[model samples]
Target chain A: MTPISFPDPDFIARQTAKMLLEVKAVHFRSDEPYKLTSGLVSPVYIDCRRLISYPRLRAALMDFATATILRQVGFESLDAVAGGETAGIPFAAWIAERMGLPMQYVRKKPKGFGRDAQIEGVLSEGDRVLLVEDLTTDGGSKVKFAEALRTAGANVTDAIVIFFYDIFPDTREALAKHDLRLHYLATWRDVLAAAREGNHFPPETLAAVEEFLNDPLAWSGANGGVDRISV
Target chain B: MFDQLLECLNEQGAGVRAYDACARMARARVSEEPDNAAAYLLLAYVAQRFVESYDDQPLSVEAASEEFQQFTDIVKMLDKAEADASADARIAALNVVAAKLNTAPKTGD
Candidate 1:
């Protein structure tokens, strides 16, 4: 399969969002807002994990991810790809293969028995590893994964995810404090735009979604979830 | 183990190879660190790949679920495996990876 050679970030973002909608991986449930790990009740929830079943689409998105990485992070800057635990593993394998780099996975924590390693594959000292995941909400896992990799001697300076919530203002700055540069194909904004352009949902539903995106914490607080995030 | 799996992958299908790669990587991990349950999990995943021939699609959803069911059954074996634990701490982990030098997916909530 040929890479799209996509240079336009906007096009990639919209296209990725469109594909997500096509697969029905993007779900809206404002009334029954789902509680997230960070304690925010979200009207929107995406399942990038489901993309693995659709090989062609997954490959295309991976290509977009590869191109984005090469363009933004530089082609030769990275030496390895590290996925964060379960969901991140598959995407990491694909991107590592695409970039011709070794792939490793970091567990949320050590296994606590046997070898008890947090890292599952061979990782070397000073390997410039790129942390990957299916999506990022507040970029909490990215920091944790990067720390594990860096602690194991991998020089992790960047991270990539298929989707980024990008709703919170502190997300980027928080990552920046830890020296992590986030790269992502799409965000809630792109998905909202796609939903709007395609009329995928009713105006009322879309408006509610927009309200949540506008101020997710406030929305959560008004809903049945916490207003602030701890992790 | 990887060589064997790659051969199966090349001869039988990409699905096997792809799953096998995950198995191999996990096997490498289990061998280095002995986690019995996870080792059983690795076996369950690898054995699941072979439950259905890569090229041959299940004729119906029922048939496909049968294959997936077999995988779950294999995973269930882990409980018994833990009960019958032997003195060798590394054996199960080693076997999982070992079966592979001859010779991997999941997601959700």
Candidate 2:
């Protein structure tokens, strides 16, 4: 498919947000905050893992992801697709199929001895790897996975995630610092807009979520969560 | 193991021929009792041809995974056999293909 034939980015974002909500991937609660892995308490919690459970939604999401990557990165740019650990595995698998490229998964830690320790599946040295994951929060995990791919002799310059936190300022910079381009289908802002437009939650809850999104560290600090994000 | 992987890769590289072979093998194996893992692995190896030969219209990863699991089971069974070195090497090659297939993407879609 040609790049322009793809759905508009704005439209994709809105629809992706709606799909996430429809599948109950996004949860909003003001009274009881959800604790993040980073130890941040927030009114909104998103579990992209749920995306794998819905076939229709998963297909649409993969289409959007495939389109975005194709638009941002050339269709022939990638040689292989690598999924990070458990959660990223399925998404990576889908992307690899869409791209019709060989697929592999990177373990969080080395599986055995040698340089290819963290890698599973056959990875040709110097082959370009497009890392895939379900979502990115601080983007830390993607960086870690990309590094592993690089260490295993993969030229990992691009990564795709179904969702990106988009709240953290350093997320993109951290990715760029590692020479990785991050491609995502939807983000926190997109979810927030969809939530507001759909009235998925109370106005106050949406506002609180918006506030948390606007200044997450400050909001988390005030809300009895970690103020500083450890690199 | 490398030789079989190369064979699978060659079959994938062969385009329509691989697809026809895989389709024929898949149908043939369907009538067999309990399904042979080798048959499934062969199907998956051939399915990669359809995936590669065609563009945009993606093969169902679910279909790919079924053959992949079959291939993996065959490898596991061979590993348990504790056969001679040549048989073990042959199993090893098949397992490489199986491992590749086992990681085949799941659409869940």
Candidate 3:
């Protein structure tokens, strides 16, 4: 297996979006908008976790991830790789293999007891850790995972995700306050561009999406969704 | 020294010997270049050798835990190493051994 070889960033984003679409990872519902756990109503949803079930697609994406991280973060910059539990674990495992690095998975909450309960495997003090996750909505969960790694004696200065919502402006700021750098393959805008180029949705639906992206709060309020994000 | 190391590894068990040899080589490689994070991983590979062959031995669960801990520490530092494709391959092979070691029970009980 080659150390690092796959899609470039642009190509990765395009193909990743395509893969998501191909696998029906993308969901669209205009009439009955689905309400997120956070109480935000959305016309679309994406499930990245399902990517693991497809071996060939998962393999290609992981190759892209390994190549991207090596090129951008330096092959040796990370001391260890941590995957946010559940969804991120498999991706982390494949990428860890590609990079030939030790792998650990972080829990959403502490397991049973003890400080290390939130962590699995071994991590050393001041280890330059890289956090891996499937997707980021508002970059909220990434901070929580980074904190867990830090508390466990890891130096989590960077994170990688397959997708980023990138709709909220403060997502980067929230990450910055905790000294976390976010790297991702694709974002909402990328998906939007792809949707336009591919004509996946009708013009009206595309226009609605554009309106939402331009000003989510205003569009949400107009569409009987939450006027302001709470959190 | 090479012969001595080999003999020491064998008497201790091939698994242990492989672990020690890999660790030794990794350390030596890293000393030649401090930026070499791959050495740390090589150490894990060495540990993995013991893990792979652990099933054949009669080690206590406690003893196995200690050995597993040592191996895990190597994986923990794998990413920080300087890039060396050959070393990375070697480390990956060791990880395969390590994973097998993780599942292999001490007494098959």
Q: Write the per-residue lDDT of candidate 1 for residues A21-40, one digit (tens) a residue.
A: 99999888777666554546
Candidate 3 lDDT over B1-109, as tens digits, reads 1233333333333333245454565566556655444444445345445534542233332454455465554444343222334666656745654575467544433
Q: Residues A159-192, candidate 2: write the lDDT tens digits.
A: 9988888888887888898898899988989998
In angstroms, the error of model 1 at B60 is 32
Model 3's CAPRI class is incorrect
Clash count, candidate 2:
2
- Model 1 residue B90 CA deviation (Å) reads 39
lDDT per residue for candidate 3 within A34-146, as digits (tens), equals 44433344666778878988999988888888878887888789888899976788888888878878889999768878677799999988888889999887676788889
Q: After superposition, how far is residue B57 of candidate 1 from its true place, in Å?
A: 29
Ranking by lDDT: 1, 2, 3
Computed on C-alphas against the true complex, the DockQ of each candidate is 0.02, 0.01, 0.01
TM-score of chain A in every predicted structure: 0.95, 0.95, 0.93
Candidate closest to the true structure, highest lDDT? 1
How close is each model in CA RMSD to the real structure? 13.0, 16.5, 21.2
Q: Model 3, which residues run further than 4 Å from truth?
A: A1-6, B1-109
Q: Flag clash pairs in model 1.
A: A115-B33, B1-B100, B1-B101, B1-B102, B1-B103, B4-B102, B5-B103, B19-B104, B20-B104, B100-B103
**Fnat of candidates, each listed:** 0.00, 0.00, 0.00
Q: Tell me the spans in candidate 2 whose CA falls farther than 4 Å from its real position.
A: A1-4, B1-109
What value does the lDDT take at residue A167 in candidate 3? 78
